[model samples]
Target: MSDAVDPRRASAALLALGAIGLWGTLAAISTRVTAVPPFLLTGLALLMGSLVGFKAFRHKPPPAAALALGVYGLFGFHFFLFLALRLAPPVEANLVNYLWPLLIVVLAPVIVPGIAWSTRHGIAALVGFSGAALLIASSAGSLGQGAWLGYAFALASAVIWSTYSLATRRFSHFPTGYVAWFCALSGVLALACHAIFEPSYVPKAPEWPFIAALGFGPMGLAFFLWDRALKRGDPRALGNLAYLTPLLSTLLLVLFGGGALTPLSIVAMVLILGGAILGSRK
Candidate 1:
């Protein structure tokens, strides 16, 4: 085969990066709406994400199976994360959840046949994960104590997301627009969970813009971009690139929230960038 990169794959990588960049903004935007309960916030953001579906209404609806998969991925990932955060030390829980990217890198070959795994891929994933873990650990010193159940929930979130993304490849024919429906249905489910398990709190006017940013960026367009990326790009490369999210998120915090970066963060940046470059190689 020629050494030149496939145009479709290149485009897919860019889309994946776009998705990751949006996701990086989640923490920053979420800080602005801390008053909203988790489930309520999720519900509102996802509902806002459903706006993307409006344009796709005339297109053929996704199959029930695809919709189910989407729901399982979207709703399950967030639900499990909520449980993890509530049941354990938030920092620890989040760290455990970040395992999804590594899972994606390692599981790609098994989940999607003919996608070969290599030593470089494994090393890249490990290095990237280490960087992400360091960044997360440095953000807030961990209490180092969490319920085992909470850890399990965090692990489940990772598994759900990795499997969801890989399994999405099985339904590559589904339109990217289907994610809008996924957001709509998932939003309803999240709201119902909020109504049942949490207190109701209407978002204040000032919080609306942040909520909209959350919806339109991280929760909304990111999914579409991710779906397109997974369907078209090499999952291993995308997975390696995903390690940048937490680092980017931390940078956003420093830039916008007046937090200062430390030497450790600089080291983390080098590790993550190096890993990403290695994994992106042909």
Candidate 2:
């Protein structure tokens, strides 16, 4: 067991929770700001995140770690996520993307030698996916309506996010603020992509607040908190904690005018949260 008094663990718990909290609000926020092109939105959001996290870059990381950052940064993860959004409903795309948390749990011990591992994690992981399956089934009819490509993008987003999170472990020693640098690099990359593929579009005045909030909160502070937490806290616990994000996100959506919560979604939430707690237990 981890020491409760350990400052690092406490910090990690707080940071992780903070990230999850902000992330829960994302669906509601994004839905309201559909006026902006996804790619351009990605670039602008990341640019803001970069600015918010800019001070952390002073610590600086080595070259190989920097390479990993460029790949996994906003450019890689957000790009895929937004692309997924372009193709499908937020419910489906987000659920598929939730695969990252479970992947983090599964991959933790493999990447970090001293971390604990167990078969129960596999069982819990399946349960988590099963919850996601239930969600998909309930909403399954929403699929195959010309969103197959979107579905593919959503799954890919999951894979990319999972891989990116695990890969960051390799260079965890780098300052957490260095994430700003990654955000900046990703912003640049995203900007280039936007310039090439997306026509220029400006956000209406009403859209600015939502867009700015996304840049500074979820994309910015949440990422820094996640990096710091992962570097200091137990991955296993953090992974289990991540199970809450989807449930919370969905609830936020309903409350924020996105939609009503479904009976099936409640059932799915039970399975997901239950599986996460049970399977993640030592």
How does candidate 2 fare on TM-score?
A: 0.86
Q: What lDDT score belongs to each candidate, Candidate 1 first?
A: 0.90, 0.74
Check candidate 1 and list the clashing pairs. Answer: none
**For residues 1-282, could you state the per-residue lDDT of candidate 2 as single tens digits?**
463477777787788889888887776788888878888887888889878866666665537656566557557777777778778776677667778777777887887658777677766776777776676456444644438777788777777776666656666767666788888778788888888979988789999888899999887788888877777777766776777777777778778776666789889889888876775353
Counted clashes in each candidate structure: 0, 0
* Top candidate by lDDT: 1
Sequence-dependent TM-score of model 1: 0.97
Q: Indicate the residue-level lDDT of 241 in model 2.
A: 71
Instruction: Report residue 118 deviation for candidate 1 (angstroms).
Output: 1.5
- lDDT per residue for candidate 1 within 230-274, as digits (tens), equals 999889999999998998898998999746688887888889988
